[model samples]
Target: MTLSFQRIAYEALNVCNGVTMAALEAAVERTGLAPGAAAIDIGTGNAAVAVRLAERFGLRVTAIEFDPVMADLARQRIDAAGAGAEVTLAVAGAADVLARSAPVDLIVALGTTNVTGEGRPTPEAGFTALRRKLRPGGWLLWGDIVWLAEPPAPLRQITEATNLYTDDAGWRAAATGAGFEVITGRISDPAEFEAYPRDAVTAVRAWLEAHPDAPEAASIRFHADRVQAITDFGRDYIGFGVYLLRNPD
Candidate 1:
């Protein structure tokens, strides 16, 4: 599962998820986890959030990304930040890390809803598995696609194939069902939501232009076109949101 284009696109994007830096930092502040607490950022694209956590919030962060390409970039980013000791980059699947690790103070899974589960990822599967990775009262900063309006069958079929999506209420229910207490959740600003795919498409286009003869150009373009089309079509029915949840104290 190498998304080479994603690495290039992330160079131009803020975070892999549609989450803004300000919003994620705010969500971290909401966690109220003190300095020196432990945190793991699953599917941490470029490990930007992880680096921020270790540097600003004084967290001992384990930034996880399975893609070697992205993980390499994250490793370089972490090393250059002089946060080598504070931020540990793990090039492994989230579920693998979660299974073996001790409970931490916070777990941040943004955009990568499949942080847990085998087949199609769902909120319930993710929440349940993640519960074991945190201590009581620990936080889960989760962000993913939410159905703003009922999607057409065609779009729904396409969306669910990658990762299961649901409305805001559906997400809250899944969290509570998995024993997490929902603290707060926010639907993204329309403009911010709009930037996600647009930024990716723009970056990919630029990369393709620069590397026109590259062997992977075709694959990258195909992915970019598919994503751009789907995103454009689904904009009316789907939106992104971040939810802050906590394990029972």
Candidate 2:
């Protein structure tokens, strides 16, 4: 099977999501999650956060990633991290995976809520669906893009074409509407927002240089360039954050 452009572009990176490792660790720490807590990481690309949860906090994690390539990569990483025993890796959509697993103390869905297949056209709907799989008082480490300021029409149109994200206040309100209490959230800094796609582009460019004749090189470059463009033009208005939310008891 042909590898997806996304996989080609991001597989080499430790974490596919835009947030930095330090940022992720800080957000997780704020949750005050105890060792041995049960957690589920939905859309766990490369198992970065999943492995951290298992290795650092000793949490038992059910990590779900829909993309086959990503799932395989995650599995490899988990094994290499010696976290295979603590993490159960599933190659399935977040909704499907959650349906089959038991309720957990935490649910983490970062940058892939659409995997829930909720027809409702917003991340809030996805959050609502995932909330059902969380035990009462459980935490959710939700991460995605949001608008820092209302953008120009062109930028707004571009962003709305693919993402249903809103501003920070909107996200907090949506969480409340989805029966979650917003604990705290941290938005990505300008440096992080700039670095993520920059790094991906650099990696893809290096790969292309090494494999000039590869059939997939063009497609990978296209994706990398697209990401870079978005990062370049949208960084002013677009932002990413990890919001810690609690399912109210």
- TM-score (C-alpha) between model 1 and the true structure: 0.96
Model 2 residue pairs with clashes: none
RMSD of each: 1.6, 1.8
Backbone clashes counted, model 1: 0
TM-score of each: 0.96, 0.92
- Residue pairs clashing, model 1: none
Judged by whole-model lDDT over C-alpha atoms, candidate 1 comes out at 0.88
Deviation from truth (RMSD, Å), model 2: 1.8
- For model 1, what is the error of residue 189's alpha carbon versus the real structure, in angstroms, after optimal superposition? 1.1
Candidate 2 lDDT, 1-249, residue by residue in tens? 555556655666766777887777777787788999999988888888899888887899999888898787788888888898899998887777777777889987788756456643576777788788888888888888889998888877766764588899999988999899988888888887667677778877888888878888788777777777777788789988889999988
Query: What TM-score does structure 2 among the candidates reach?
Result: 0.92
* Residue 137's lDDT in candidate 2: 83
Q: Give lDDT tens digits, candidate 1, residues 1-249.
A: 354778888877768777688898998898878899999999888888899999889999999998899998898889989999999988888888888899999998887845664866668988898988989889999999999999999999987876888999999999999999999999998889888889989999988999898888999999898889888899899889899999998
